[model samples]
Target: PGHQGTSLKVTDSPRKRGYYVNSPTYGGFDIMTATVGGVWDSFLGEGRRFWITATSDSHRNVEDGGEDLWPGQYAKTYVWAAPDQADIMDGLRHGRIFVTTGDLISELDMDIAGANVGDTAQVKAGQVVTLKVRLRDPAGPNANSDQPELKRVDVIMGDITGKADVKADSNPTTRVIKRFTAADWTRDGEVITFTYSFKAERDGYIRLRGTSTDELEPQADALGENPWPDLWFYSNPIFIRAR
Candidate 1:
């Protein structure tokens, strides 16, 4: 799971896998909080960059006996490549992408001292850098027949200490460094902007995650229960190197 620059496939439901995210017998972790978080943290612990993508895993519709949403109906992965297929594949391979669920967010512009996602920038050790983010929720009704409003954005940081300092199963040094609330900012239309600065005590990576629901905490799902209407998005990590 902690593979090198590999893209991790995450989804809220994996029906045929015998363990959905809310399954009572073997499920408790939301893919965003548990699966993707754990993978990104572990990669950072190994001083490597990792990427993530979401899928609907739709084989057929409910009328046809499938329990998954149609592809691109509720979740999407946007890749920042050129029109060429090769370039698109290259972009996906290089982690220039973001994932969204229920069309909660339509656009995200993130930069770390001007370095965009999938880019690494050089800076002095212990340097303080500003992370700027601009995001916009979809302007109109989404798949759920309601416009999703972003409620919170979380900034997660993880120290890249190399493989020598990493554990096989978990990365203890990774955590959410900051959380921006919608109530703390004045919105313009559907867009919101956030800026924060942090000292790069050592080499590390930062990423963003946001949700549309007001539930600050992840609620446990009852056995066989699935909440498909909740909306969320996750951006790829931006790496930093100290000179």
Candidate 2:
């Protein structure tokens, strides 16, 4: 992906979607780190219902002189669906998904105003809504055979400012509005839960990003960076509709 990778010359059709932030692209190239978050911010700035998923990008591996992982051995996209063709397809199309790397988490559920990820919550103009997140962080070792811990979780929120400039590559309105830690949450067995409230004064969206490292933002993937110690999990956005 090119720097920011946003431009107005692209397709405007509803069916059109830009490139995705796959694991290989982000983990293999130091230059692509900025592009990863740029795409996320740019889409939400447009108020479009865009989504992202993790991929193993299976082609080769570090052992094979290529940066890839066995499919689902490292990065995985989890969809909320029944074990059926129709429901599975439907869940994907509607963005009922979360992604994790290195098995940092086995379960994640986030909701606001009873609307889960990829769903829209209708509210009064300035309704205060509570966001609740429950996640299961198993103590079992990951693919690397080392158990990585979840040290922090970030709450990223962005505005729905309507259509965007085709060339816009950044959403200045989006940011890690909150960073939660053990002191901020409660743990029950292997499950940890976090809750926070915000004012929904306008159309916007909120999603999540968590990591085992202390980097406030994901550092650019460095050469030979141990992937296991630096794990991440991401959830699709939950839209807010203020009436």
Candidate 3:
């Protein structure tokens, strides 16, 4: 909530779908949910093209007991774009991006049929949508000088229920549809691959979350906890449009 019973007009015109900026530093702030409900609130129920981003917002040096890390030391927003500035800007505008914390994975490319992240794939309602993913775990020490292992990856799906009460903020239909482990994926050196298929019962979106721990879902951070040991990575969704 933006205070006093107001919500972002994402279900309105494209011009009204405001951007969302989040940082791990304040994960428990939004309505005190400490989860992606706000993101799902805007994305699901309408298939709206809202955008989300993670930032450092670093201003002071940590050595002085400031609350921040050096840019990319613990968080990064990876854009699937050329090295050029304009292309990267375009990628951000179009949602071709993924985010990671503590360097859990270096790459994540997911596809459904011929559509990639931020792209829409057309399909029949009963069609089976094959998901192919390619990702890499650096397997090296992260900013914290600790080597972390990727424990699992989860697939989350949510239906496009078509608009919502402007005051609405939750999608009850959203859930984790699949979970992949070392046995569930193929490995080649530092890269990992996964394949899955699900029926296109309706229009929806799918996204990925990979972590270094066995926690079914990301747990809220605790004080004095080593951030690098509990790493996680998340990819922007791939929308599905079905007849």
- Candidate 2 backbone collisions, by pair: 7-166, 8-166
lDDT of 1 at 15: 30
The residue-by-residue lDDT of candidate 2 on 34-117, one tens digit each, is 233476677876977677777555555545544455777777788989999999888888889988888888898999988999
lDDT of 2 at 130: 94
Ranking by lDDT: 2, 3, 1
lDDT of each: 0.66, 0.72, 0.70
Using Cα atoms with residue i matched to residue i, what is each candidate's TM-score against the true structure?
0.81, 0.83, 0.84
Query: Candidate 1 lDDT, tens digit per residue, 38-118?
Result: 655776567665677776556554545555556776678888878999999988888888888767788888898778877
Worst 10 residues of 1 by lDDT: 1-10
lDDT of 1: 0.66
TM-score of 1: 0.81
Model 1 residue 23 distance off true place after TM-score fit, in angstroms: 6.2
User: Which prediction has the highest lDDT against the true structure?
Assistant: 2
Question: Which model is ahead, 2 or 3, in terms of lDDT?
Answer: 2
